[model samples]
Target: MTEIESATTPAAAHRRPASLRDWLAPPIPGSALWGWLGPLFVTLFAGFLRFDRLGVPKAVVFDETYYAKDAWALLKFGWEHKTVKDADSLLIRDGSDAKIWEDGASFVAHPPGGKWMIAIGEAIFGATPFGWRFTAALAGTLSVLILCRVARRMTGSTLLGCAAGLLLAVDGLAFVTSRTALLDVFVMFWVLAGFACLLIDRDRSRRALAEKVEDGVGGSLGPFVMHWWRVAAGVCLGLACAVKWSGIFFIAAFGIMVVLWDAGARRAARVRNPYAGAIGLDALPSFVSLVVVGLLTYLATWAGWIFKPGGWGRGEVAGNPLLRPLEAMPDLWRHHKDILDFHNGLTTAHTYQSWPWDWPILRRPVAFFYTEPRDDCAAARCSREILGIGTPAFWWGATIALIVLVGVWLVRRDWRAGAILLGFMAGWLPWFVPAFGDRTMFLFYATPMLPFMALAVALALGLLIGPARQATVHLARHAPSANRRLLGSAVAGAYLLMVLVNFAYFYPVLAAKIIPYEDWDARIWFNSWI
Candidate 1:
């Protein structure tokens, strides 16, 4: 056995009971195709659900008006340009004479990266529903795969990885957000990829520590660098930031999380003054590899705007003798400053806006598509149109599971649990600060956080179904109550069934497939949901 394996093996043994301790490291076979079938199933299932009727509701749903049209503009001009009113109608009814943007420039909030993505679909399929929402569906489907990889890596169990992927696949919010043409899914995919990369780094770093200790291979070691993996994470996070500024929260959280892992590693390695060694060796290089590289990548996403002479804010500094030098500097630099200001100053109140507390409870879900029906129902009925609500059972159950993880982390100091919680906070909590003012943020923005929440819930579920605790082992012999263990397993299984059933119950609304108004109302359990 490798030295590192020998060293960590004992800890794994201690976690198991004396009976199973001899086989502490279970033999994980190398049936690569069979091993990955679970994650692939999850991905294909997510893909099928997302791609079904993807182009329906044929008009511009919430935010699609901006992104869809901009996507078309981007394809034509290589950058987003302003559109005239009623552009979607014009684009839909035979690609007609749409107004092209003049040299004056149009101001916009958020960055250009996501719209650029939407343009790719438009280039292939034209400015249609399928064209706009294609990328969102693809990203959402891929997130399930990434989550599976992450969970498998963390838990070392294919079962738990499949469980995590299944949980995310059934989430109503994730379902709705995935079907829509929005930037958040892209952000979620990148952030999830970054998290997966960090988890990989953790595993590799721990292995490296084990090797050092096993060989007594330590004493002021040089910077412990894994150049390619860290660089890949930086690139992914940079793309995330380009999608939405909320990604910055992830960069900070994951950065600190990894550094702390380093500290723990040094301690594990028995390094004298491990923190000092880590700071001098790992910190600065990591910052350069991750943060500096990420920032440059984010800037490069604005290249089209930089090159375009008539893009938004492109000529703000033009014509004035004093402003000539500033304008000549770079169009994107000026545009970025303006975009930043717009994001910071956005405190306007919105009707469907809700608080973070309301988020966990799914109190105020934004209805992305709603209609007052004329005569589309059973009982001479008035039907309310519907879309943009979270899966009640999944999210509510996840809240309960998150509470359980807090206790698990406190009692067991389980590093995996802590990592999951860190991701949850990074994606979900920071929005509350911006949410303080009356800004119009929807529950869909919470999409980025849903995977972590689902994972947290899965971790809790894993604990319940996992190997019996040492204390509980006596029950198999002394207590003479097989009923109790059976009951516990039954309860956990029932909860999983209920979550899936609930997801199915809400799937119609989530995908915005037209159903009876009363059926939609039946799904809306809370007044705040409307």
Candidate 2:
């Protein structure tokens, strides 16, 4: 038989490729229209949910008292100014009171990136509850869009990608964080953006390596390519850190992830001494891109503090040994020390503060707003609350799914599973250490992990739905049979429907709609939830 005939034979078609590069080839293509349209539809739906009745509860909720005021101060002045007594009631009762704010600066624990973002909304909407929260809603909506695109790239299925986006859009924690003028939402947005950039970099780098090898320009050792996507990832991570210091964990985790990806790419290219080559060629540049660039970006976020005089910690350094080197910039050193001290010394007990381990299990959620009504409602008594809890079905299901993914990574060596785990760990593991300390933490700190949890659920569903087993001329497609595919797809669809129903059931409490007391009690599954 001729070479073409031999290649088309059934036996030959069943044979796998020997090269590592061939095994790591790009995923099969799917419908082009659904790729973008699916994500857009989900994002629009999320936007509606987040923006509707966003101004309700007109009073500041939870920590919004701190962040909202800080944001308004940042908008008016360059730094946060101390607010007068009863500022929350003052802001709610009297919209036009410039005198409510005191002149002196106030100490802030977190970085300025999130407050700066809130300032943009305050600038446009005039510092009301809705005004302070507008940017968070926008960021949350954008996160859905980003996750859809990232999931599509990771799973090679537009349907599954959109599924992930939809899951995140309806998640209660995501909605709550987005609607509140808190820093965690910004941290979630930026961390997810950075992870998406790294995904793009992985695909681009692998393709480049393949192309170089195929062109016969080089042998096993591939050319050192300049990856701009990695730089973008670094910038995103830096912005994440600027928003919240906890984002530093993601920076560390993702930095290691990308370097390992480089080594894997080289090994797939059959490069001799791939590990050493990766270290010598890729590691240093990766550090400069992710770590050094991130540091500079973080410093840039302090421009408002650096240039303005009389901001908190702008003077009077205590002459600490470690901070003395920064004495030349007294304001910078003092500000850094002050923030460090505030975070480390925080031991104030809060009723809603939860342990980190409890976060994944939906325990002890923070109540952002709540009210009991006697006459406003038809019922004898009614409850209105905005609870920062996740959709239990999604969160609990994802915990199990993530555990399965660990096995998938170990046994199947699936890169997607590994990536999902890395994303989840980056957001979660750091908080576990702080849980042992006196510092108060809440379940909403798990906000950054929610996207990864959604991704994990999507991936698990994709596995259940099986592949689209199209027939080829040479080989018989026995696995992923038509009946099997149909059954799997149906099961996956049913699960999604269940998630939608759960979200609907909990929507009242999440959005703070007044409901009969008994109805509110029905939604609270446990005493801890109450």
On lDDT, the candidate that comes out on top is 2
Weakest ten-residue segment in model 1 by summed lDDT: 1-10
Kindly report which residue pairs in candidate 1 clash with one another. 371-385
Q: In candidate 2, how many Å is residue 224 off?
A: 0.3
Any runs in candidate 2 off by more than 4 Å, and if so which? Answer: 1-28, 93-97, 217-221, 315-330, 473-478
Question: What TM-score number comes out for model 2?
Answer: 0.92
The candidate that wins on TM-score is: 2
Give candidate 1 misplaced runs (Cα > 4 Å). 1-31, 95-97, 100-103, 212-218, 221-223, 316-331, 372-379, 382-386, 468-488
lDDT of 1 by residue, 290-349 (tens): 799888888777766655556675643345555554454566677678877777787777
Q: Any idea what lDDT model 1 has?
A: 0.73
Q: Which ten residues in a row have the lowest lDDT in candidate 2?
A: 1-10
Per-candidate Cα lDDT values, in order, are: 0.73, 0.83
